[model samples]
Target: MCTLTCIAISLIIAATIYYLRFVRTKPKLDIPSRDRVVVVSGAAGGFGTAICRDLLSRFNARVIGLDISKEVMEKVYSEELKQYGSERLSFIECNICKLEECEKASERIAQILKEWKTDRVFALVNNAGVSNSPKCTERMGIVEYPEDELLDVFGSNLFGHVRMTRLLYPLMKDGQDGHNGAIINVASVAGLLALGFFGFYTSSKFAMVGFTDSLRREMKSLGKKGLRVTCIEPGFSKTAILNLKPQADTEFGRIGVIREKKSAAILRNAQPPKVIGDAICEQIFSSNNLPHLIIDYWYMRLVYLFLYYTGLDL
Candidate 1:
Protein backbone atom coordinates (compact mmCIF):
# COMPACT_ATOMS: atom_id res chain seq x y z
CA MET A 1 0.00 0.00 0.00
CA CYS A 2 2.85 2.37 0.82
CA THR A 3 4.53 1.61 -2.48
CA LEU A 4 1.30 2.21 -4.39
CA THR A 5 0.82 5.55 -2.65
CA CYS A 6 4.37 6.58 -3.53
CA ILE A 7 3.83 5.63 -7.13
CA ALA A 8 0.63 7.66 -7.26
CA ILE A 9 2.39 10.67 -5.80
CA SER A 10 5.20 10.33 -8.31
CA LEU A 11 2.74 10.15 -11.20
CA ILE A 12 1.01 13.26 -9.89
CA ILE A 13 4.27 15.16 -9.73
CA ALA A 14 5.23 14.10 -13.21
CA ALA A 15 1.87 15.17 -14.60
CA THR A 16 2.13 18.51 -12.86
CA ILE A 17 5.57 19.11 -14.28
CA TYR A 18 4.49 18.12 -17.79
CA TYR A 19 1.48 20.40 -17.66
CA LEU A 20 3.54 23.34 -16.49
CA ARG A 21 6.31 22.89 -19.01
CA PHE A 22 4.31 21.96 -22.11
CA VAL A 23 0.61 22.70 -21.67
CA ARG A 24 0.96 26.06 -19.96
CA THR A 25 3.93 27.39 -21.87
CA LYS A 26 3.18 30.48 -23.95
CA PRO A 27 4.27 30.93 -27.54
CA LYS A 28 7.02 33.41 -28.40
CA LEU A 29 5.55 34.79 -31.64
CA ASP A 30 4.81 38.47 -32.10
CA ILE A 31 1.25 39.69 -32.20
CA PRO A 32 -0.05 41.00 -35.48
CA SER A 33 -0.03 44.75 -35.85
CA ARG A 34 -3.19 46.79 -35.43
CA ASP A 35 -3.52 47.35 -39.18
CA ARG A 36 -4.17 43.68 -39.93
CA VAL A 37 -7.66 42.08 -39.85
CA VAL A 38 -9.07 38.76 -38.59
CA VAL A 39 -12.18 37.08 -39.94
CA VAL A 40 -14.41 34.79 -37.84
CA SER A 41 -17.26 32.74 -39.24
CA GLY A 42 -20.34 32.03 -37.07
CA ALA A 43 -19.38 35.20 -35.25
CA ALA A 44 -22.73 35.35 -33.49
CA GLY A 45 -22.19 32.10 -31.64
CA GLY A 46 -20.58 31.78 -28.23
CA PHE A 47 -17.06 30.83 -29.30
CA GLY A 48 -17.00 33.12 -32.30
CA THR A 49 -18.23 36.12 -30.33
CA ALA A 50 -15.69 35.53 -27.58
CA ILE A 51 -12.80 35.24 -30.04
CA CYS A 52 -13.81 38.37 -31.96
CA ARG A 53 -14.17 40.39 -28.79
CA ASP A 54 -10.82 39.16 -27.48
CA LEU A 55 -8.97 39.98 -30.69
CA LEU A 56 -10.55 43.41 -30.86
CA SER A 57 -10.23 44.34 -27.22
CA ARG A 58 -6.96 42.67 -26.25
CA PHE A 59 -4.96 42.76 -29.50
CA ASN A 60 -6.62 45.82 -31.06
CA ALA A 61 -7.24 43.80 -34.19
CA ARG A 62 -9.85 44.67 -36.79
CA VAL A 63 -12.38 41.83 -36.73
CA ILE A 64 -14.97 40.94 -39.34
CA GLY A 65 -17.80 38.58 -38.32
CA LEU A 66 -19.51 36.32 -40.84
CA ASP A 67 -22.78 34.56 -40.00
CA ILE A 68 -25.83 33.31 -41.84
CA SER A 69 -28.32 35.28 -39.76
CA LYS A 70 -28.58 38.93 -40.76
CA GLU A 71 -30.45 39.75 -37.58
CA VAL A 72 -27.81 38.21 -35.29
CA MET A 73 -25.05 39.87 -37.27
CA GLU A 74 -26.78 43.23 -36.93
CA LYS A 75 -27.18 42.68 -33.19
CA VAL A 76 -23.51 41.80 -32.73
CA TYR A 77 -22.51 44.67 -34.98
CA SER A 78 -24.53 47.12 -32.92
CA GLU A 79 -23.13 45.93 -29.60
CA GLU A 80 -19.50 45.64 -30.70
CA LEU A 81 -19.58 48.80 -32.76
CA LYS A 82 -20.47 50.71 -29.61
CA GLN A 83 -17.51 49.33 -27.70
CA TYR A 84 -15.05 49.28 -30.64
CA GLY A 85 -15.67 51.56 -33.58
CA SER A 86 -16.61 50.35 -37.05
CA GLU A 87 -12.93 50.26 -37.91
CA ARG A 88 -12.32 47.63 -35.28
CA LEU A 89 -15.46 45.56 -35.75
CA SER A 90 -17.52 44.78 -38.86
CA PHE A 91 -20.07 42.18 -39.98
CA ILE A 92 -20.86 40.41 -43.24
CA GLU A 93 -23.79 38.10 -43.83
CA CYS A 94 -22.56 34.92 -45.40
CA ASN A 95 -24.06 31.49 -46.04
CA ILE A 96 -20.82 29.59 -46.07
CA CYS A 97 -22.37 26.50 -47.63
CA LYS A 98 -22.70 28.36 -50.90
CA LEU A 99 -19.53 28.74 -52.94
CA GLU A 100 -20.80 31.82 -54.75
CA GLU A 101 -21.66 33.49 -51.46
CA CYS A 102 -18.20 32.75 -50.09
CA GLU A 103 -16.62 34.26 -53.20
CA LYS A 104 -18.70 37.40 -52.87
CA ALA A 105 -17.90 37.71 -49.20
CA SER A 106 -14.22 37.36 -50.01
CA GLU A 107 -14.50 40.22 -52.46
CA ARG A 108 -16.20 42.40 -49.89
CA ILE A 109 -13.56 41.55 -47.30
CA ALA A 110 -10.83 42.52 -49.76
CA GLN A 111 -12.51 45.87 -50.22
CA ILE A 112 -12.77 46.36 -46.48
CA LEU A 113 -9.07 45.64 -46.02
CA LYS A 114 -8.19 48.09 -48.81
CA GLU A 115 -10.32 50.75 -47.17
CA TRP A 116 -8.59 50.13 -43.87
CA LYS A 117 -5.30 50.78 -45.65
CA THR A 118 -4.08 47.25 -45.01
CA ASP A 119 -3.59 44.69 -47.75
CA ARG A 120 -3.50 41.56 -45.59
CA VAL A 121 -5.81 39.21 -43.73
CA PHE A 122 -4.16 37.99 -40.57
CA ALA A 123 -6.33 34.94 -39.92
CA LEU A 124 -9.56 33.13 -40.70
CA VAL A 125 -11.47 31.33 -37.90
CA ASN A 126 -13.76 28.65 -39.27
CA ASN A 127 -16.14 28.33 -36.31
CA ALA A 128 -19.55 27.85 -37.88
CA GLY A 129 -21.09 24.40 -37.24
CA VAL A 130 -24.23 22.44 -36.43
CA SER A 131 -24.53 19.69 -33.81
CA ASN A 132 -26.30 16.40 -33.62
CA SER A 133 -29.81 16.51 -32.22
CA PRO A 134 -32.07 13.90 -30.58
CA LYS A 135 -32.28 10.53 -32.29
CA CYS A 136 -35.07 11.46 -34.71
CA THR A 137 -34.55 15.21 -34.79
CA GLU A 138 -32.96 15.18 -38.24
CA ARG A 139 -29.20 15.18 -37.45
CA MET A 140 -28.59 11.98 -35.61
CA GLY A 141 -27.35 8.52 -36.69
CA ILE A 142 -25.99 7.68 -40.11
CA VAL A 143 -28.42 4.87 -40.98
CA GLU A 144 -31.63 6.82 -40.41
CA TYR A 145 -30.23 10.32 -40.56
CA PRO A 146 -32.12 12.55 -42.96
CA GLU A 147 -30.20 12.72 -46.21
CA ASP A 148 -30.79 16.45 -46.52
CA GLU A 149 -29.64 17.11 -42.96
CA LEU A 150 -26.58 14.96 -43.53
CA LEU A 151 -25.74 16.97 -46.62
CA ASP A 152 -26.24 20.20 -44.74
CA VAL A 153 -23.94 18.99 -41.97
CA PHE A 154 -21.20 18.09 -44.42
CA GLY A 155 -21.75 21.33 -46.28
CA SER A 156 -21.56 23.64 -43.28
CA ASN A 157 -19.02 21.76 -41.20
CA LEU A 158 -16.59 20.77 -43.95
CA PHE A 159 -17.27 21.95 -47.49
CA GLY A 160 -18.24 25.43 -46.35
CA HIS A 161 -14.81 25.96 -44.81
CA VAL A 162 -13.26 24.44 -47.90
CA ARG A 163 -15.05 27.02 -50.05
CA MET A 164 -14.12 29.84 -47.70
CA THR A 165 -10.47 28.79 -47.65
CA ARG A 166 -10.35 28.45 -51.42
CA LEU A 167 -11.80 31.90 -51.87
CA LEU A 168 -9.57 33.54 -49.24
CA TYR A 169 -6.28 31.69 -49.88
CA PRO A 170 -5.07 34.12 -52.50
CA LEU A 171 -5.44 36.99 -50.06
CA MET A 172 -3.79 34.94 -47.29
CA LYS A 173 -0.92 33.63 -49.41
CA ASP A 174 2.55 34.31 -47.96
CA GLY A 175 3.36 37.12 -50.40
CA GLN A 176 -0.13 38.59 -50.37
CA ASP A 177 0.68 42.16 -49.40
CA GLY A 178 3.71 41.20 -47.27
CA HIS A 179 1.63 39.63 -44.50
CA ASN A 180 1.79 36.24 -42.86
CA GLY A 181 -1.57 34.59 -42.10
CA ALA A 182 -3.12 31.66 -40.24
CA ILE A 183 -6.21 29.52 -40.69
CA ILE A 184 -7.83 28.34 -37.47
CA ASN A 185 -10.24 25.46 -37.93
CA VAL A 186 -12.47 24.67 -34.94
CA ALA A 187 -12.91 20.93 -34.91
CA SER A 188 -13.96 18.87 -31.83
CA VAL A 189 -12.71 16.01 -29.68
CA ALA A 190 -15.43 14.03 -31.38
CA GLY A 191 -13.31 14.29 -34.48
CA LEU A 192 -10.66 12.23 -32.78
CA LEU A 193 -13.01 9.90 -30.93
CA ALA A 194 -15.95 8.38 -32.73
CA LEU A 195 -18.82 8.93 -30.34
CA GLY A 196 -21.65 6.40 -30.68
CA PHE A 197 -24.68 8.62 -31.29
CA PHE A 198 -22.98 11.55 -32.91
CA GLY A 199 -22.08 9.77 -36.09
CA PHE A 200 -22.81 12.63 -38.47
CA TYR A 201 -21.16 15.29 -36.36
CA THR A 202 -18.16 13.06 -35.65
CA SER A 203 -17.75 12.17 -39.29
CA SER A 204 -17.77 15.84 -40.28
CA LYS A 205 -15.15 16.76 -37.68
CA PHE A 206 -12.96 13.82 -38.70
CA ALA A 207 -13.01 15.11 -42.24
CA MET A 208 -12.19 18.58 -40.99
CA VAL A 209 -9.11 17.31 -39.15
CA GLY A 210 -7.96 15.43 -42.23
CA PHE A 211 -8.39 18.49 -44.41
CA THR A 212 -6.47 20.71 -41.99
CA ASP A 213 -3.60 18.25 -41.85
CA SER A 214 -3.43 17.98 -45.65
CA LEU A 215 -3.61 21.75 -46.05
CA ARG A 216 -0.81 22.33 -43.58
CA ARG A 217 1.49 19.91 -45.40
CA GLU A 218 0.56 21.30 -48.80
CA MET A 219 1.27 24.87 -47.70
CA LYS A 220 4.70 23.90 -46.41
CA SER A 221 5.61 22.03 -49.59
CA LEU A 222 4.39 24.91 -51.76
CA GLY A 223 6.83 27.34 -50.07
CA LYS A 224 4.12 29.25 -48.22
CA LYS A 225 5.96 29.00 -44.93
CA GLY A 226 4.39 32.23 -43.74
CA LEU A 227 0.92 30.73 -43.86
CA ARG A 228 0.06 28.50 -40.88
CA VAL A 229 -2.91 26.17 -40.59
CA THR A 230 -4.09 24.82 -37.26
CA CYS A 231 -6.90 22.62 -36.02
CA ILE A 232 -8.45 23.20 -32.57
CA GLU A 233 -10.16 20.18 -31.05
CA PRO A 234 -12.08 21.29 -28.00
CA GLY A 235 -13.99 19.06 -25.63
CA PHE A 236 -17.64 19.73 -24.87
CA SER A 237 -18.47 23.23 -23.68
CA LYS A 238 -21.61 25.06 -22.57
CA THR A 239 -22.34 26.32 -26.05
CA ALA A 240 -25.59 26.52 -27.98
CA ILE A 241 -24.70 23.19 -29.50
CA LEU A 242 -25.49 21.45 -26.27
CA ASN A 243 -29.17 22.36 -26.75
CA LEU A 244 -30.04 21.24 -23.22
CA LYS A 245 -33.66 22.23 -23.58
CA PRO A 246 -36.98 20.57 -22.81
CA GLN A 247 -36.25 18.06 -25.50
CA ALA A 248 -33.18 17.02 -23.58
CA ASP A 249 -35.53 15.58 -20.94
CA THR A 250 -37.23 13.25 -23.39
CA GLU A 251 -36.31 9.60 -23.72
CA PHE A 252 -34.70 10.25 -27.06
CA GLY A 253 -32.93 13.33 -25.78
CA ARG A 254 -29.18 13.87 -25.81
CA ILE A 255 -28.96 12.11 -22.45
CA GLY A 256 -30.51 9.08 -24.02
CA VAL A 257 -27.10 8.21 -25.40
CA ILE A 258 -24.55 7.09 -22.87
CA ARG A 259 -21.81 8.68 -24.92
CA GLU A 260 -23.56 12.06 -24.84
CA LYS A 261 -24.28 11.78 -21.12
CA LYS A 262 -20.62 11.14 -20.48
CA SER A 263 -19.75 14.11 -22.62
CA ALA A 264 -22.22 16.30 -20.78
CA ALA A 265 -20.76 15.26 -17.46
CA ILE A 266 -17.29 16.23 -18.59
CA LEU A 267 -18.72 19.52 -19.75
CA ARG A 268 -19.79 20.12 -16.19
CA ASN A 269 -16.14 21.01 -15.76
CA ALA A 270 -15.79 22.34 -19.27
CA GLN A 271 -13.75 25.39 -20.01
CA PRO A 272 -15.64 28.49 -21.04
CA PRO A 273 -15.70 30.00 -24.53
CA LYS A 274 -13.12 32.57 -23.51
CA VAL A 275 -10.59 29.83 -22.83
CA ILE A 276 -10.89 28.59 -26.38
CA GLY A 277 -10.72 32.14 -27.73
CA ASP A 278 -7.59 32.89 -25.77
CA ALA A 279 -5.97 29.65 -26.95
CA ILE A 280 -6.66 30.52 -30.56
CA CYS A 281 -5.21 33.97 -30.09
CA GLU A 282 -2.13 32.44 -28.52
CA GLN A 283 -1.75 29.99 -31.41
CA ILE A 284 -1.95 32.80 -33.95
CA PHE A 285 0.61 34.98 -32.20
CA SER A 286 2.99 32.19 -31.16
CA SER A 287 6.07 31.27 -33.17
CA ASN A 288 5.58 27.54 -32.72
CA ASN A 289 4.46 25.46 -35.71
CA LEU A 290 1.71 23.69 -33.76
CA PRO A 291 -0.62 21.77 -36.02
CA HIS A 292 -3.20 20.76 -33.40
CA LEU A 293 -4.41 22.35 -30.17
CA ILE A 294 -6.58 20.39 -27.74
CA ILE A 295 -8.42 22.48 -25.18
CA ASP A 296 -10.02 20.51 -22.36
CA TYR A 297 -9.66 19.44 -18.74
CA TRP A 298 -6.49 17.68 -17.66
CA TYR A 299 -8.09 14.25 -17.54
CA MET A 300 -9.67 14.63 -20.96
CA ARG A 301 -6.39 15.80 -22.35
CA LEU A 302 -4.67 12.77 -20.90
CA VAL A 303 -7.27 10.43 -22.33
CA TYR A 304 -6.99 11.99 -25.77
CA LEU A 305 -3.21 11.86 -25.74
CA PHE A 306 -3.16 8.26 -24.57
CA LEU A 307 -5.67 7.16 -27.15
CA TYR A 308 -3.88 9.07 -29.86
CA TYR A 309 -0.50 7.60 -29.02
CA THR A 310 -1.84 4.10 -28.67
CA GLY A 311 -3.81 4.26 -31.93
CA LEU A 312 -6.82 3.26 -29.87
CA ASP A 313 -10.27 4.26 -31.08
CA LEU A 314 -12.78 5.22 -28.44
Candidate 2:
Protein backbone atom coordinates (compact mmCIF):
# COMPACT_ATOMS: atom_id res chain seq x y z
CA MET A 1 0.00 0.00 0.00
CA CYS A 2 2.85 2.42 0.77
CA THR A 3 4.57 1.67 -2.53
CA LEU A 4 1.31 2.10 -4.48
CA THR A 5 0.65 5.42 -2.78
CA CYS A 6 4.16 6.69 -3.60
CA ILE A 7 3.90 5.60 -7.25
CA ALA A 8 0.54 7.30 -7.64
CA ILE A 9 1.84 10.48 -6.06
CA SER A 10 4.89 10.43 -8.30
CA LEU A 11 2.70 9.97 -11.36
CA ILE A 12 0.59 12.93 -10.39
CA ILE A 13 3.65 15.11 -9.94
CA ALA A 14 5.06 14.03 -13.28
CA ALA A 15 1.79 14.78 -15.04
CA THR A 16 1.60 18.21 -13.48
CA ILE A 17 5.17 18.97 -14.51
CA TYR A 18 4.54 17.84 -18.08
CA TYR A 19 1.38 19.92 -18.30
CA LEU A 20 3.13 23.03 -17.07
CA ARG A 21 6.15 22.60 -19.29
CA PHE A 22 4.73 21.54 -22.70
CA VAL A 23 0.96 21.55 -22.50
CA ARG A 24 0.37 25.06 -21.20
CA THR A 25 -0.31 27.55 -23.93
CA LYS A 26 1.91 30.57 -24.30
CA PRO A 27 0.49 34.00 -25.04
CA LYS A 28 0.60 35.34 -28.57
CA LEU A 29 1.48 38.92 -29.40
CA ASP A 30 0.57 41.15 -32.31
CA ILE A 31 3.15 43.79 -33.16
CA PRO A 32 2.18 46.93 -35.02
CA SER A 33 3.02 45.85 -38.58
CA ARG A 34 1.05 48.34 -40.65
CA ASP A 35 3.08 50.16 -43.38
CA ARG A 36 6.34 48.57 -42.20
CA VAL A 37 8.71 47.02 -44.74
CA VAL A 38 8.97 43.19 -44.79
CA VAL A 39 11.20 41.25 -47.15
CA VAL A 40 10.40 37.64 -48.14
CA SER A 41 12.82 35.71 -50.35
CA GLY A 42 11.57 32.86 -52.59
CA ALA A 43 8.42 34.92 -52.53
CA ALA A 44 6.92 33.64 -55.76
CA GLY A 45 5.85 30.01 -55.36
CA GLY A 46 5.16 27.38 -52.73
CA PHE A 47 4.72 28.83 -49.25
CA GLY A 48 6.42 32.05 -50.32
CA THR A 49 3.41 33.42 -52.24
CA ALA A 50 1.07 32.62 -49.39
CA ILE A 51 3.34 34.22 -46.76
CA CYS A 52 3.61 37.41 -48.79
CA ARG A 53 -0.16 37.55 -49.20
CA ASP A 54 -0.71 37.16 -45.48
CA LEU A 55 1.74 39.96 -44.66
CA LEU A 56 0.20 42.24 -47.27
CA SER A 57 -3.52 41.58 -46.71
CA ARG A 58 -3.65 40.75 -43.02
CA PHE A 59 -0.90 42.95 -41.60
CA ASN A 60 -1.34 45.70 -44.23
CA ALA A 61 2.48 45.90 -44.42
CA ARG A 62 4.52 47.01 -47.37
CA VAL A 63 6.04 43.79 -48.77
CA ILE A 64 8.86 43.41 -51.27
CA GLY A 65 8.99 39.83 -52.61
CA LEU A 66 12.37 38.51 -53.82
CA ASP A 67 12.13 35.59 -56.24
CA ILE A 68 14.25 34.10 -58.97
CA SER A 69 11.40 33.19 -61.28
CA LYS A 70 10.34 36.03 -63.56
CA GLU A 71 7.40 34.13 -65.02
CA VAL A 72 5.92 33.46 -61.62
CA MET A 73 6.62 37.06 -60.63
CA GLU A 74 4.55 38.43 -63.53
CA LYS A 75 1.61 36.24 -62.58
CA VAL A 76 1.70 36.99 -58.84
CA TYR A 77 2.24 40.68 -59.51
CA SER A 78 -0.77 40.87 -61.79
CA GLU A 79 -2.97 39.27 -59.16
CA GLU A 80 -1.67 41.14 -56.09
CA LEU A 81 -1.11 44.53 -57.69
CA LYS A 82 -4.82 44.96 -58.19
CA GLN A 83 -5.56 44.36 -54.54
CA TYR A 84 -2.64 45.94 -52.65
CA GLY A 85 -1.19 48.30 -55.30
CA SER A 86 2.53 49.12 -55.72
CA GLU A 87 2.93 50.90 -52.40
CA ARG A 88 2.02 47.79 -50.41
CA LEU A 89 3.23 44.93 -52.62
CA SER A 90 6.01 44.47 -55.19
CA PHE A 91 8.35 41.73 -56.51
CA ILE A 92 12.05 41.73 -57.40
CA GLU A 93 13.44 39.11 -59.77
CA CYS A 94 16.88 38.08 -58.56
CA ASN A 95 18.70 34.82 -57.93
CA ILE A 96 19.56 34.74 -54.25
CA CYS A 97 22.48 32.36 -54.86
CA LYS A 98 24.34 35.01 -56.88
CA LEU A 99 26.00 37.71 -54.73
CA GLU A 100 25.73 40.42 -57.38
CA GLU A 101 22.05 39.68 -57.87
CA CYS A 102 21.40 39.91 -54.13
CA GLU A 103 23.32 43.20 -54.04
CA LYS A 104 21.14 44.62 -56.80
CA ALA A 105 18.05 43.45 -54.98
CA SER A 106 19.17 45.20 -51.79
CA GLU A 107 19.76 48.42 -53.69
CA ARG A 108 16.23 48.34 -55.02
CA ILE A 109 15.01 47.71 -51.49
CA ALA A 110 16.97 50.74 -50.33
CA GLN A 111 15.21 52.87 -52.92
CA ILE A 112 11.84 51.58 -51.73
CA LEU A 113 12.68 52.39 -48.13
CA LYS A 114 13.83 55.89 -49.08
CA GLU A 115 10.65 56.56 -50.97
CA TRP A 116 8.52 55.18 -48.16
CA LYS A 117 10.53 57.25 -45.66
CA THR A 118 11.25 54.19 -43.54
CA ASP A 119 14.90 53.53 -42.67
CA ARG A 120 14.37 50.20 -40.90
CA VAL A 121 13.32 46.76 -42.09
CA PHE A 122 10.67 45.02 -39.95
CA ALA A 123 11.32 41.42 -41.01
CA LEU A 124 13.27 39.16 -43.35
CA VAL A 125 11.83 35.70 -44.22
CA ASN A 126 14.53 33.47 -45.73
CA ASN A 127 12.19 30.86 -47.23
CA ALA A 128 13.80 29.97 -50.55
CA GLY A 129 15.43 26.51 -51.03
CA VAL A 130 16.03 23.73 -53.55
CA SER A 131 16.23 19.88 -53.49
CA ASN A 132 18.03 17.46 -55.79
CA SER A 133 15.95 14.71 -57.35
CA PRO A 134 17.39 11.24 -56.94
CA LYS A 135 18.59 10.08 -60.30
CA CYS A 136 18.25 6.40 -61.25
CA THR A 137 21.89 5.71 -60.57
CA GLU A 138 23.89 3.54 -58.16
CA ARG A 139 24.86 6.44 -55.92
CA MET A 140 24.23 4.90 -52.53
CA GLY A 141 25.72 7.47 -50.22
CA ILE A 142 27.00 11.06 -49.90
CA VAL A 143 30.28 9.87 -51.43
CA GLU A 144 28.46 9.00 -54.68
CA TYR A 145 26.72 12.39 -54.85
CA PRO A 146 28.21 15.06 -57.09
CA GLU A 147 30.19 17.66 -55.15
CA ASP A 148 28.96 20.53 -57.31
CA GLU A 149 25.32 19.72 -56.60
CA LEU A 150 25.99 19.68 -52.84
CA LEU A 151 27.52 23.17 -53.10
CA ASP A 152 24.52 24.37 -55.11
CA VAL A 153 22.13 23.22 -52.43
CA PHE A 154 24.11 25.01 -49.73
CA GLY A 155 24.41 28.09 -51.93
CA SER A 156 20.68 28.63 -52.02
CA ASN A 157 19.65 27.20 -48.66
CA LEU A 158 22.39 28.55 -46.40
CA PHE A 159 24.98 30.93 -47.88
CA GLY A 160 22.49 33.00 -49.85
CA HIS A 161 20.40 33.66 -46.77
CA VAL A 162 23.56 34.44 -44.83
CA ARG A 163 24.46 37.10 -47.40
CA MET A 164 21.00 38.62 -47.21
CA THR A 165 21.13 38.83 -43.43
CA ARG A 166 24.58 40.46 -43.53
CA LEU A 167 23.56 43.09 -46.08
CA LEU A 168 20.23 43.81 -44.34
CA TYR A 169 21.81 43.85 -40.87
CA PRO A 170 22.20 47.62 -40.91
CA LEU A 171 18.60 48.19 -41.94
CA MET A 172 17.15 45.84 -39.31
CA LYS A 173 18.87 47.69 -36.46
CA ASP A 174 17.00 45.44 -34.01
CA GLY A 175 14.71 48.09 -32.58
CA GLN A 176 17.49 50.65 -32.32
CA ASP A 177 15.40 52.78 -34.68
CA GLY A 178 12.30 52.06 -32.52
CA HIS A 179 10.80 49.25 -34.64
CA ASN A 180 11.57 45.65 -33.64
CA GLY A 181 13.24 43.49 -36.29
CA ALA A 182 12.81 39.78 -37.04
CA ILE A 183 14.36 37.04 -39.17
CA ILE A 184 12.38 33.88 -39.98
CA ASN A 185 14.10 31.03 -41.79
CA VAL A 186 11.84 28.42 -43.39
CA ALA A 187 13.41 24.98 -43.05
CA SER A 188 11.85 21.60 -43.68
CA VAL A 189 11.36 18.75 -41.19
CA ALA A 190 14.16 17.05 -43.03
CA GLY A 191 16.35 19.53 -41.25
CA LEU A 192 15.60 17.75 -38.02
CA LEU A 193 15.67 14.20 -39.38
CA ALA A 194 18.24 12.50 -41.58
CA LEU A 195 16.02 11.35 -44.41
CA GLY A 196 17.69 8.93 -46.83
CA PHE A 197 18.68 10.00 -50.35
CA PHE A 198 18.30 13.69 -49.38
CA GLY A 199 21.93 14.04 -48.37
CA PHE A 200 22.38 17.44 -49.99
CA TYR A 201 19.05 18.86 -48.89
CA THR A 202 19.30 17.53 -45.34
CA SER A 203 22.86 18.74 -44.90
CA SER A 204 21.89 22.25 -45.95
CA LYS A 205 18.91 22.33 -43.61
CA PHE A 206 20.95 20.96 -40.69
CA ALA A 207 23.33 23.85 -41.27
CA MET A 208 20.39 26.25 -41.36
CA VAL A 209 19.00 24.93 -38.08
CA GLY A 210 22.37 25.43 -36.42
CA PHE A 211 22.76 28.87 -37.97
CA THR A 212 19.36 30.03 -36.73
CA ASP A 213 20.30 29.06 -33.17
CA SER A 214 23.67 30.78 -33.34
CA LEU A 215 22.16 33.88 -34.87
CA ARG A 216 19.66 34.15 -32.04
CA ARG A 217 22.46 33.91 -29.49
CA GLU A 218 24.53 36.46 -31.37
CA MET A 219 21.65 38.92 -31.36
CA LYS A 220 21.18 38.61 -27.62
CA SER A 221 24.89 38.81 -26.91
CA LEU A 222 25.14 41.89 -29.10
CA GLY A 223 22.41 43.54 -26.98
CA LYS A 224 19.82 43.57 -29.75
CA LYS A 225 16.86 43.19 -27.42
CA GLY A 226 14.29 43.71 -30.14
CA LEU A 227 15.70 41.38 -32.75
CA ARG A 228 14.04 37.93 -32.82
CA VAL A 229 15.45 35.17 -35.01
CA THR A 230 13.35 32.02 -35.50
CA CYS A 231 13.23 28.94 -37.65
CA ILE A 232 10.10 27.08 -38.86
CA GLU A 233 10.25 23.39 -39.83
CA PRO A 234 7.38 21.98 -41.86
CA GLY A 235 6.60 18.35 -42.65
CA PHE A 236 5.37 16.74 -45.86
CA SER A 237 3.46 19.39 -47.75
CA LYS A 238 2.03 19.76 -51.23
CA THR A 239 4.57 22.23 -52.55
CA ALA A 240 7.07 22.61 -55.37
CA ILE A 241 9.54 20.63 -53.27
CA LEU A 242 7.68 17.53 -54.40
CA ASN A 243 8.11 18.37 -58.09
CA LEU A 244 11.24 16.22 -58.30
CA LYS A 245 10.54 13.53 -60.85
CA PRO A 246 12.12 10.09 -60.41
CA GLN A 247 12.69 8.44 -63.78
CA ALA A 248 11.51 4.94 -62.92
CA ASP A 249 7.98 3.76 -62.04
CA THR A 250 8.79 1.24 -59.34
CA GLU A 251 9.10 2.28 -55.71
CA PHE A 252 12.72 1.16 -55.29
CA GLY A 253 13.71 2.38 -58.76
CA ARG A 254 12.49 5.90 -57.91
CA ILE A 255 15.44 6.22 -55.50
CA GLY A 256 14.18 8.42 -52.64
CA VAL A 257 10.42 7.92 -52.76
CA ILE A 258 9.21 4.96 -50.75
CA ARG A 259 5.78 3.63 -51.74
CA GLU A 260 5.10 1.16 -48.96
CA LYS A 261 1.83 1.37 -47.05
CA LYS A 262 3.08 3.44 -44.14
CA SER A 263 5.07 5.82 -46.30
CA ALA A 264 2.23 6.20 -48.77
CA ALA A 265 -0.15 6.98 -45.98
CA ILE A 266 2.08 9.80 -44.85
CA LEU A 267 2.38 11.23 -48.34
CA ARG A 268 -1.29 10.75 -49.20
CA ASN A 269 -2.23 13.04 -46.35
CA ALA A 270 0.38 15.72 -46.92
CA GLN A 271 -0.72 19.16 -45.78
CA PRO A 272 -1.03 22.09 -48.12
CA PRO A 273 1.79 24.59 -48.15
CA LYS A 274 -0.57 27.42 -47.27
CA VAL A 275 -0.82 26.16 -43.69
CA ILE A 276 2.85 27.04 -43.32
CA GLY A 277 2.07 30.64 -44.27
CA ASP A 278 -0.72 30.91 -41.74
CA ALA A 279 1.44 29.34 -39.03
CA ILE A 280 4.34 31.76 -39.58
CA CYS A 281 1.95 34.71 -39.56
CA GLU A 282 0.49 33.50 -36.30
CA GLN A 283 3.87 33.06 -34.59
CA ILE A 284 5.98 35.83 -36.17
CA PHE A 285 5.44 38.46 -33.49
CA SER A 286 4.61 36.26 -30.51
CA SER A 287 6.43 37.35 -27.35
CA ASN A 288 7.21 33.89 -26.07
CA ASN A 289 10.71 34.09 -27.56
CA LEU A 290 10.12 30.83 -29.36
CA PRO A 291 13.25 29.42 -30.98
CA HIS A 292 11.55 27.15 -33.50
CA LEU A 293 8.16 25.83 -34.54
CA ILE A 294 7.68 22.27 -35.83
CA ILE A 295 4.63 22.59 -38.06
CA ASP A 296 3.83 18.98 -38.81
CA TYR A 297 1.11 16.35 -38.57
CA TRP A 298 0.22 14.78 -35.22
CA TYR A 299 1.79 11.42 -35.94
CA MET A 300 4.89 13.05 -37.33
CA ARG A 301 5.81 14.34 -33.92
CA LEU A 302 5.56 10.83 -32.53
CA VAL A 303 7.53 9.32 -35.39
CA TYR A 304 10.35 11.80 -35.12
CA LEU A 305 10.34 11.64 -31.34
CA PHE A 306 10.59 7.89 -31.41
CA LEU A 307 13.29 7.98 -34.03
CA TYR A 308 15.09 10.71 -32.19
CA TYR A 309 15.21 8.97 -28.83
CA THR A 310 15.75 5.35 -29.73
CA GLY A 311 18.25 5.77 -32.53
CA LEU A 312 15.94 3.52 -34.51
CA ASP A 313 16.93 2.68 -38.05
CA LEU A 314 13.33 2.81 -39.21
- Global lDDT for candidate 1? 0.76
How do the residues 126-157 of candidate 2 rate in per-residue lDDT, one tens digit apiece? Answer: 99988753232332345565667677778889
lDDT of each: 0.76, 0.75
**Per-residue CA lDDT of candidate 1, range 243-285, in tens?**
6433334344444355555555565766788988888877776
Which portions of model 1 miss their true places by more than 4 Å?
1-21, 133-139, 175-179, 224-226, 244-259, 309-314
Report the C-alpha displacement of residue 91, candidate 1, in angstroms: 0.7
At residue 261, candidate 1 shows an lDDT of 55
lDDT of 2 at 139: 24
What is the RMSD, in Å, between candidate 1 and the native fold over all Cα?
4.5
